[model samples]
Target: MTPDEISTYEETLGVLGDIDHRVVERVLREAGWSPCGAGDWAVALRAPDGRAAARISPFDLVAPYTVALYREAAHTRQVPRLFAHRRLVGGGDLQIMEWLEPVDADEAAGFHRALAAREPEVAELADVVRRVHERGRRDQPWFAPKLDDNPDNIMRNADGRLVAADLFGADGPRLYAAVVDDPHLVVTTIPEPERRFMTDIPLTNTGPWPPEVRAAMHESLTTADTTHQA
Candidate 1:
């Protein structure tokens, strides 16, 4: 990215004013967005042409370190694409990302069943988490903050594979402890009971796995390191 682009991005985020509806609109408009909906510090918007979805936030600056870590994760594809990160002109941080489509009830149910079955899907998720951790370790060597690792952060794409999202955290590593540590996990963000079942085993952990899962996790970390190095 050019210095000018970076400067403009930062300026736009800095203009958010006070993290309210008015500020959200101003920031979105400055960033070329059309308002859709909003939550507390976060606001949803569509690209000018309506070809993509985006979200703006003032919360990113609340924990700048964690936000940097998330940007690193995005670079490694350990998380979703990060379209933009900047300080609004009024005085807040903003992040724009590719809006992901919602996972359907049937698909959500299948994901739940697959996770419960402890089949290959859970293993795959474990691998993804491992990659995320590895990326965090290398990019932010002194700070290896744990991800939320909740169902809401995990989205399924057109091919029916899970992708992780949401990059903010309350603290270093235990943001969403329940989902990460639970042996029987279900992502409750989506309404469908069947699709809600994510993985039977919590994919985020320190170690001591069943050999295979552990191995995959190790590989993910190693690959992440090597890829970044290259």
Candidate 2:
């Protein structure tokens, strides 16, 4: 989108407030986001020390939502480090987050193996998912599984642990609960792009899950369906 259009979209998404456009222009200029691109937002800067990346968004409130959920997920260690959140004086929201390298296919495969192995550390993943579910039950927000589960959003630390990155989607709380209640249901129904992205690592088939996991998944799906009906 054009820069002006991007500004408009940011306003629509509540990323921007009714302030002088010059303020936003200044931030963009200082941040080196002058070289604009199509998407509703732009990556403004990579932190001087290279610890975080600052991004600006105009369309779809994904980034801000992601920041919000990431903050919540951080409490339970379901997500990586979140640096900062700020509203631009002119327009749009700025999200600064710790920079993380995307997980590659091979790495993703390893993560899958770790999950399947059910090692003690793997329990952390389940705990993260469970925390998300508890938060979802309490908040009832729309959740986007793809964003949460995509390999691109997964990261590895120096210690070689898998951590979630992005968070933007629908209601955070509701979606988190749905995932915990029915892990496979959402993953299975995801569109082709997301499905392909997530399925790159071959996890066990949900059709024949371990009894406890299966029961939990069924319960999640049922809760989601019932929520929709109500």
Best by TM-score: 2
- The C-alpha stretches of model 2 lying farther than 4 A from their native spots are 1-29, 32-44, 59-69, 72-78, 87-93, 112-119, 133-142, 145-147, 157-161, 171-230
What's the TM-score of each model vs. the native?
Answer: 0.43, 0.45
For model 1, what is the alpha-carbon lDDT of residue 99? 51
User: What is the C-alpha lDDT profile of model 1 across 73-167, one tens digit per residue?
Assistant: 44334344555665443324456555565665565555545543546745554444455555555543223355443455456543444555553
Q: Which candidate number maximizes lDDT?
A: 2
lDDT of 2: 0.47
Q: Kindly give the number of clashing pairs for every candidate.
A: 17, 12
Query: Which sections of candidate 1 miss by over 4 Å?
Result: 1-24, 30-32, 61-71, 74-78, 89-91, 105-150, 156-161, 171-230
Query: How much does candidate 1 score in TM-score?
Result: 0.43
Q: What overall lDDT goes with each candidate model?
A: 0.46, 0.47
